[model samples]
Target: MESHPPAGGHSVRTRSQHQRRKRIVQAAAALASRGGVEAMQMRTVAERAGVALGTLYRYFPSKMDLVVAVVGEEIDLLESSIERRPPGASTPASRAVDVLMRATRGLMREPELADALIRSLIMAEVQTPFGDRMTGLLLRVSAEGLTLEQASEEQRDLAGSLASVWVQELLEMLRGRRTYDQIQRRIETAAARLLAGI
Candidate 1:
């Protein structure tokens, strides 16, 4: 008996496959930004990406998969933006609030993307990958800018939970449920009052 090759004649992705996946993801995001998540259908996304419909499905098992990946990419971009900021503040509260304010303004600039992400989160359609990755990025970035003497395991967990709340509240503020001034004032006032009372 002789060994046989796979059906596609290649078992691993080539550079072309990597480029194809990138294009597909970009197309999906463009569609998502223009018409919301509904525009991210396999057929439409493939058409936009210049790939076959089967290829799109091959890359993304579900709609949630693609959207979650998009969310992850956006979060990475935001993380990089923070990484570029010069680290200065010494106090934990000061550093944390500075990072939060910077992130809030970034989200405000992308209302459509923020809306889509929030819908995915609230509907429970997206899964845990984004939350975990972005939370770690945020903690590392904030820790670098703050004077916290190494975040303990418990403190790290608390920071992750607080980050989730901050993101959700920021989305709500973007949706006009709360004004920007209100959110800004509330965040600073809470932090300041807590520090003062402590």
Candidate 2:
């Protein structure tokens, strides 16, 4: 006899798994938005997600994992905004500035939640699968912010690299290491440097 999955078993399992994960991520995001990373209790997440406590643990082994997941979701949301620029948004350097400025404005509006998520992302090194995804999203979003007609492939790559550096610089500014105007100037300068002559 050949071994085979039962009828609809694999598809059903995959869909249910996806739904469960979505539920958990949404619940965790809601809690974090309301009270930051400190409020994201695994038991509370499990309850809110309608999954058993053990299932929540299986999905996210610790608070850090859950926090990282929440941050990843936020990054996804940020990408949408970054990609939505006006047609008049020309100049690769200026577009790069626009993307970073939008992200900065968002974090400023939600200071507490930003603090929690940024800290979690920095500290999350154990089994961190989300870091690469975050970087990839940032790169793609940065790339989208530029005008393909005006930018060469090299310029686009440089713009993406500058975008990543801008995120780290923003984190530093958030930590009170530098004044707002100083970081703004630095980001603008860096953006111009990366896409010089464009």
User: TM-score for each prediction?
Assistant: 0.77, 0.70
Q: Per-residue lDDT for 1-198 in model 1, tens only?
A: 373322121243577877787887788788878767776677899898999877776777667667766776777787787678743576544555676677777767767766776567556554445556545554565455322346566655655665666666777785689777777766665544333311
Per-residue accuracy of model 2 over 1-198 as CA lDDT, tens digit each? 573332211232467777887788889888877887778788899999999888887677677877777776677777676556532356656665766677777877777678777778778776544444433443344455335345566754675567567768867877888666777898888877875654
Indicate which candidate wins on lDDT.
Answer: 2
lDDT of 2: 0.68
> What are the Cα lDDT values of the candidates?
0.64, 0.68
Error of 1 at 115 (Å): 1.0
After TM-score superposition, the amount by which residue 54's alpha carbon in candidate 2 deviates from its true location, in angstroms, is 1.5
